[model samples]
Target: MSRTASDQSLDGLADGSSVVVVSPERIDPDARVRDFDQLSASAQRLFVSEEETNPATAADLDPGDVVRFTDYYRVR
Candidate 1:
């Protein structure tokens, strides 16, 4: 699918930057409202609201808000 502002925003991130993943489904209210890192240490992945998720492609998204997972990484 084509990209959107949110997708472009994420693409602009520096290599190895810490990022919390989110899809187009049921975004964790906590994560959506608060910081992604605020979740528990074990919670490497968090949900994102439809308004917050990127790549605004219907094909990319599931019936509900999608859930994406990724480890937090920082550039050295």
Candidate 2:
């Protein structure tokens, strides 16, 4: 069964709490996010290339991919 934000009925379940964990993709500072019809000044900003994660990120991605949120303002 799908989980929700609040479903405390898992008390009787043998497994861990029925609480669902939501992990949203965080926009990296270096990554460029489309705001509207155009790209912002973040053109210099590099972002995760859809293969990386905040934690437990596998090297399945590229190096130029945004590895950290602070990679943008870190400066060259």
| Maximum-lDDT candidate | 1
Residue-level error in angstroms, candidate 2, position 5: 17
RMSD of 2: 13.6
| Cα lDDT tens digits for candidate 2, 1-76 | 1222222332353443222222224334564322221323333122222322221122222322322232221111
Indicate the TM-score of model 2. Answer: 0.17
Clashing pairs in 2: 30-45, 30-46, 31-46, 47-66
RMSD, one per candidate, in order: 12.8, 13.6
User: In candidate 1, what are the lDDT values of residues 1-76, reduced to their tens digit?
Assistant: 1112233345555542223333434254543232334434333221232233322232323222323334221111
Reference-based lDDT, each prediction: 0.31, 0.26
